[model samples]
Target: MSTPVIFIHGLWLHASSWQPWADLFTEHGYQTLAPGWPGDAETVEESRANPDAIAGHGIDDVVEHFARIIKGLDTKPILVGHSFGGMIAQKLLGLDLGAAAVAIDAAQIKGVLPLPLSTLRSGFPVLSNPANSSKAVSLTPQQFRYAFGNAVSEEESQELFDKWSIPAPGKPLFEAAAANFNPHSPAKVDTANESRGPLLLIAGGKDHTVPEVVVRSTLKQYRHSHAVTDIIDFPDKAHSLTIDSGWREVAETSLTWLKEQNL
Candidate 1:
């Protein structure tokens, strides 16, 4: 049977943000799906005008959201997720639901070491507001460029902002730092063993929210994998590799990994 692939997005992005990647995976003979986080709005415009529509979305909500989709699938699926979505992907693997998993520029998980200055700065935008605890916040152009597309060009950045950008829930970011620290944190994932399948982590060197040190630290958590578990860092890429100047390269790499696992 052909292995399926599911794409999960991170903060400030709806699942439609992954259309190009999903379509790319489809061309490669893999069944692909990108499921939105609960309460995500229909479009960037709607998400901007009223982010409340997507507020209160947490990590557990997203993981369970995709889990439901997986339950209906004809086969077990490989998961590819970015940033916060990457964290959710790990949670799915912890649940032993994935056939294989690719976490690209994945967020920090408990027990993984190293916290970069950039990672702390990326959260600076919303760290202080109590409203942000349950609110969705939009990124300013400068903020987006700084946190996600620092290495991409202006026109390309503009295109990404116009097409895939939207307000994102702050709850996950708030939960990520606490998930492993706090007993009640919902951001906690249970990737205790590699029973879920093979695992790969793609790190963007210039990513502000998940730096190389952070990705390197993730290895220990995946030590339980019986399948191949490792990380590959793209030095010139930033957090937006999937949509930035070199998306096809990232996709090709991920495709190569998936093809090896199932073909």
Candidate 2:
């Protein structure tokens, strides 16, 4: 049987954002599933209309939620995730949950150093307000432009913001930022686990949210692991690499890499 593929979305975007990716992967003969964070709405319009639905959820909540979904599947799936979801994919892989995994511009887990200024600025919306730690924060068009659409044109940035941006819980951002200081933080990952399935970390060279420096730091942490770990860099792309006009290129790259691993 063909290995199933599960797509995990990041903050501010719902599972619906992965529809095009799912369609493409399905055409390639992989059954795809994009499960949402707790309380995510079916549509971006609905999420915007009722932000409360996605509020108050934290990293642990989302990780457990996706874990349950993976556990119920007939076979371990090939996990693909973006941003925060990418970190989640790694966490799941540490638990020996997936057949293989791909993390696109993944958020940093504990032990990753070299936090860049651009990454801080990208997360300012949530970090600036302490109250936001327990609330959901929405991105302004300008913020989204800098963090998620820098590689796209102005018109395309606006369109992406309107269609995919929604409120995201602030707790996860705070937890990730403070992960190193907290011994019990959920942002911790077992990068050295030998049982972690083959993993790929995709980096966007121009991505402010997860620059190459940060991604390399993440890669460095996994260096001691016996599991297969690899990285590919798109030097001109930004955080929107997964959803921009050239998204198909990124998707194709991932598909090709997975095929090489015979997953």
Candidate 3:
């Protein structure tokens, strides 16, 4: 039987963000689950209007939340995460909770040093204000356009903005920046551990937040992974690769890769 597929979402997004991906996997005979981030509402509109409820959701909390869900599954699951969720998936693997993992358009890892202006600007609304640390902050339409929808056309971008854009916690971004140096930093993940499982890092070609330079730099740093480690770069894609115009292509590619492994 195919192992269950666990989907974790990034900041400003709820578990529903993975519904399309989960449905595709389900049709492929994989059991699917996409758990909400701590304090996230049950629906997109609900979460967007009530960002205060999910504020201060740090990496450690997300990691533990996913770990608990995986532990409840009948078998070890294939963990897939996006952006901040990818960061949490890295931590989940470090905890030995998954059969394998796919990190898509993920946040910076320990050795990933490149930080683009777009990435910085994406978090600008939160980090720019000290008060934002304790509460959620909304992104202006232009900011979202540049950070997430740059690869898609104007119509699709607008549709995405209206449906999925929302406020998010600022704590995790601050934590990820200093994770490598602080031994007690909760954002830290053990990417150097080779025995965890196979890892595939998927990069969006046009992603401004997680540029190719950053992903390439991470792969180079983690050159000694025991299990298979590969990168699939999707050209003409943006930061919102999961639900973009070509999301099905990305999801199919990921499932095909998994089928080659311990599906």
- Output the number of the TM-score-best candidate: 2
lDDT of 2 by residue, 133-158 (tens): 88888999999999999999989989
Candidate 1's displacement at residue 168, Å, is 0.8
Taking all chains together, each candidate's TM-score versus the true structure is: 0.94, 0.98, 0.95
lDDT of 1 by residue, 64-182 (tens): 88999999998878999998888888888878888878999998887775877788888877766867979888887778888887889877777788888888888888887666678
Pairs in steric clash, model 1 = none
What lDDT score is found at residue 63 in candidate 3? Answer: 84
Prediction 3 global C-alpha lDDT? 0.81
- Model 2, which residues run further than 4 Å from truth? none
Worst 10 residues of 1 by lDDT: 187-196
**TM-score pick, better of 2 and 3:** 2
Prediction 1 TM-score vs. true: 0.94
lDDT values for all models: 0.82, 0.91, 0.81
Error of 3 at 37 (Å): 0.3
Sort by lDDT, best first. 2, 1, 3
Q: List all candidate RMSDs to the true structure.
A: 1.6, 0.8, 1.5
- List runs of model 1 lying over 4 Å from the truth: none
